[model samples]
Target: ASHAEGTPGQAVAKAASAATPLAAAGGANHGARAMPGNALPPYPEAAREDGLEGLVRLAVEVDAQGRVSAVRWDARSGVMLLDIAARDAVRLWRFEPARQDGQAVASTVRVALQFRLDAPVGWVAQADTR
Candidate 1:
C-alpha cells in the first residue's frame, strides 16, 4: 500500500485493467532496476520544505521497447509538488516490456508510489510507481 525506507509497510500495486490478461497474469514488471527496487525520484524542494508525504498512484504504459510511453495520474498525494514529482520521474522509468504469446507488446499497469520524509538523516524514502 505504501513503502518508506527506514519505516514500516512496503510499496504495493494492483491491476488497473480488467481486459489486460497479460498484466493480470503477473506478466507486468514494475521497473528496470539492475538491483532490486525502482528508481527513487529526487525530493522536490517544495515537498521537502513543506514536509509532505503520501502515496501517488499512476497508470503507466510501457511500449514493446521496454520504455515508458505514457503516464497518467490515477491518484494524487494531494500535494501538487508531490504529484508532479512522481509524474516526472515515472516518465523516465524503463520497464521489462510485457509479452503475450512470446511476443513483446505494449501494456498498461498501475503502480502505487509512496513518498515519505519522516526517516532519519541519510535515510531517504524512495518512491516506486509502475
Candidate 2:
C-alpha cells in the first residue's frame, strides 16, 4: 500500500470488474472499445526488487480516430516507477473510438491497471469506467 519515495516500477490497483465501460458519455451504447493486443508496459525491475505493488489510475483521452491523444495520472500507486509504466503503456493503446450519433467522437475515460506479483505479466490491466 506504500512505497519509499522515488521507487521505480509500474503502478497498479485492485482487480477490475469485467466488461467495464470505457466512457460515461452515451454509456454502453457507444461502440468504442480497446483493440486487442495492446502491449502492456514491462514491470519496472527496480520496483520488483523492492516487492512494491499497487494500482495506477489514469485519465486517458482517446481521439475520434481511436488513437490515444493524451494521458494524465488521475491517481498514483505511491511508486513513481509504477505510475510511469502505466502512463507509458496506456499511451500506445488504440481504441475503437467513442461514437456519438453513430459518428466517432473524442472522449475521456479512466482506467485502473493492477500490479500484483501473483498475476501473470501484463494480465492485470482492466478498463475502469468510474
Candidate 3:
C-alpha cells in the first residue's frame, strides 16, 4: 500500500510491519516492549495545517533498567517536522527491556509512529518489536 493512502490505523500497522530492523542479527527471546501509559508524540502544527501525514520508524535503544538510552531514525516519514516530533517524544519513553535467559538486557527495537490528520488527537502511533 502507498504510504500516503490508508485509513488512520491501517497506515501505522502497514508501515510498522514493513519497517527495517536495526536490532542485532539474532532475535531476542523477548524483545523490548513499550510500557503502558507512555505519552504519544504530539502532531506538529505545521504538518497538521498542511495536511501532511506519514509514518516514522525509529530504532529505539532500551537499557536494562528500562530507560530509553538512544533513538535513531530507521525510516523517515518524509516530513521533517513529524520526524523530529516522533524522535523527541520517543526519547522519553520507558520500556520493559528485552530478556535473554530470563534476565533483562539492553536491546534496540523498531518503533513505527504515524502522523495522520484524520486520527484523533493523541492517538496515531504504535510501537512494535523487531
Candidate 4:
C-alpha cells in the first residue's frame, strides 16, 4: 500500500503495481452494464509495489450514481497482498451513471489490470526495493 509515491515518471509503474491481485477465487461479480457510457476506470490504488510484474482481473458493480458497488476479485498471480490491494482500491472508483430510459440505473463492469515493472531492472530504488 505504501511503496513508491505514484508520480508522472512512474505512471506505468504505479498502474502496474495497482493491478496485480493477491488472491485467486471464483463467484466474483463481473459485469459492466453500468459503465456510465464513459471511459474505463483505473485500478483503485496506483501505487502497488511501485511497479510489480503481472496483471489482475476483477469484477465490480457500479451504482446508479456511478460509484463502485460490490467488489469481488481473485488474484491470478497468487499474491495475497496484491490481490487485496487491488480489490480494496477498485471498490472506491466512481463511474459515470449508467443511463436507462433517460434515468440512472445500476450496472456491473469487469476490469483487467496490467502491471508492467518500470523499476530499474538491476538498480531498484529505495522505494521499490521492498
Candidate 5:
C-alpha cells in the first residue's frame, strides 16, 4: 500500500528513507551530528503539555586524557538564558571520549537539552557523593 499515484504507503516509506540522510547532512554541516539511528524514547505527554522545550547543540573538545578541555556551541537555541544554562550544565557532563583509528582523539559532540518546568527527578549520584 503506497501513496504515490496509486501506491498505498510507498511514498511515506520513500520520504522517510530520504529524510535520514538529509538530516545527517544538515547536522554534519553544523560541525556536529546527532546520535546515529538510535530512536530516543518518545517525549511524554506531560512534557509536551507543560511547554518544556529547549535543545542546545554543543561541540566539546576532548583532551588526550579523555577529558573535556573545552565546549562551544554548534548551534544556538536563540534563548540566551537557556543557552547559558545549557552551556554551564554541559561543562559538568562527562562522556566516553572519542577516538580515531585506535588512539584517543578529540571530537565534537552534539547534545540536546530538554528542560521540564516540573518536579525534580531527584539528586544526581555524583553530586550526592561529592
Candidate 6:
C-alpha cells in the first residue's frame, strides 16, 4: 500500500527493519514506533494559500531516549515550504525507542506526511501504518 494516499493531516509511518533482520522477523527486536499525541506538522501558510499538496517521505532516527536524533528525506514533496515544514515538525516528535533483547536501542523509521488544503485547520487525523 502506498502511504501517499490519505486525507490531509493524516500521516502513515512505517518502520523499515532493513538494518535489523530480527525486527523484520518479528523477533524480540522491535523498531522505533511513534508515540501518541505528537503534534502534526503545521501546514505552511503560504503553501496552503497556494493550494499546494504533496507527500513527503522522511527517514527519522530515534535515539534510545525516544527523542529524534536526526531526520533526512527519503523523498521530497517538491515544494520547499512543505518539505521544510514536515522536517521541522518531525524533529520535535518523540517515539518509543526500538527494543533489542529487552533493551532500548536507537533505530530509524520512515514517515510519510501528506499535505492537503481541504483538511480542517488545527486538526490532525490519527496516524496509521500501511
lDDT of 4 by residue, 26-123 (tens): 12322223222222223334445344455566766777676776877634545554456556656766655444445666765555544444431111
lDDT of each: 0.56, 0.65, 0.66, 0.42, 0.39, 0.67
Better of 4 and 6 by lDDT: 6
Better of 1 and 2 by TM-score: 2
Residue 53 displacement in candidate 5 (angstroms):
3.7
In candidate 3, which residue pairs clash? none
RMSD of each: 7.7, 7.4, 6.9, 12.8, 13.6, 7.2
Residue 94's lDDT within candidate 3 is 82
Comparing 1 with 3 on lDDT, the higher-scoring candidate is 3
Tell me which residue pairs clash in candidate 5. Answer: 1-8, 1-9, 2-7, 2-8, 2-9, 2-10, 3-7, 3-8
Tens-digit lDDT track of model 6 for 1-130: 2234244444433322233344455666677777765666767778877888888888888888889888999889899998998889889988878888878888777777767775522322122221
Off by over 4 Å in 6: 1-27, 120-130
Candidate 2 local lDDT, 81-102, one digit each (tens) = 9889889988998877767666
Clashes in model 6: which pairs? none
- In model 4, how large is the Cα lDDT of residue 96? 51
Model 4 vs truth, CA RMSD: 12.8
Q: Residues 1-130, candidate 3, lDDT per residue (tens digit)?
A: 2333344422223222221232233355566767765666666877888889888888888888889998999899899998998899889888777777667888876777867778632322233432
Better of 3 and 6 by lDDT: 6
Provide the lDDT at 86 for model 3.
82
Worst 10 residues of 1 by lDDT: 120-129
Sorted by lDDT (best first), the order is 6, 3, 2, 1, 4, 5
What does candidate 5's lDDT look like per residue over 34-116, in tens digits?
22222222223444465554455656564545455677877676655556665675565554444343444455554554333
Runs in model 2 deviating more than 4 A are 1-28, 121-130
